[model samples]
Target: MKEKYPNLHRMALDYLSVPATSTAVERVFSQGRQLLHFTRNRLSGNSVRAFLCLGSWMRHDVVSPEDLIAIIRQKRKRPSE
Candidate 1:
């Protein structure tokens, strides 16, 4: 069928590549909403962006807590008086 209908076949493949549900996107949005709640509204935009990126990475197991701690330790700054 693809040989006879190449365009239709490509369209079908593209459609299939899309997610069947929005659950993953919705979860990300929900997490962002929780992070930006009233009590935390004072967070700077860059801080929020960092938090969200870190959360996503943690959720996906791209970075472990130990790894993150090590990275922080490596970048820690000495107090300047």
Candidate 2:
């Protein structure tokens, strides 16, 4: 198979090196789907990645929920002007 499909093998090696299709990946995808509603469909890839990473961190207790609350409050404290 390798000899007959050398190019396909290389392509698979290159593109199939991503993370496993685990439950965690499915959970993130589910959350991202919810975020892609008409209002938020414009979210950039980076924003979606950040949102997912943050949620993952909180879910795993890498960052405390209270810290997220404080961060949100800090963001809200900024003056629009």
TM-scores for every candidate against the unseen true structure: 0.56, 0.58
* Candidate with the greatest TM-score versus the true structure: 2
Q: Where in model 1 is the C-alpha error above 4 Å? A: 1-23, 74-77
lDDT of each: 0.73, 0.72
Across 1-81, the per-residue lDDT of candidate 2 in tens digits comes to: 779976555545443556666885687689888877778878899998777666656555556789889999999999987
In angstroms, give how far residue 42 of model 1 lies from its true place.
0.9
RMSD per model, one decimal: 10.9, 11.9
Which candidate gets the maximum lDDT versus the true structure?
A: 1
Tens-digit per-residue lDDT, 1-81, candidate 1: 989976556555543455568996697689889999888888998998688767765665655789989988877864555
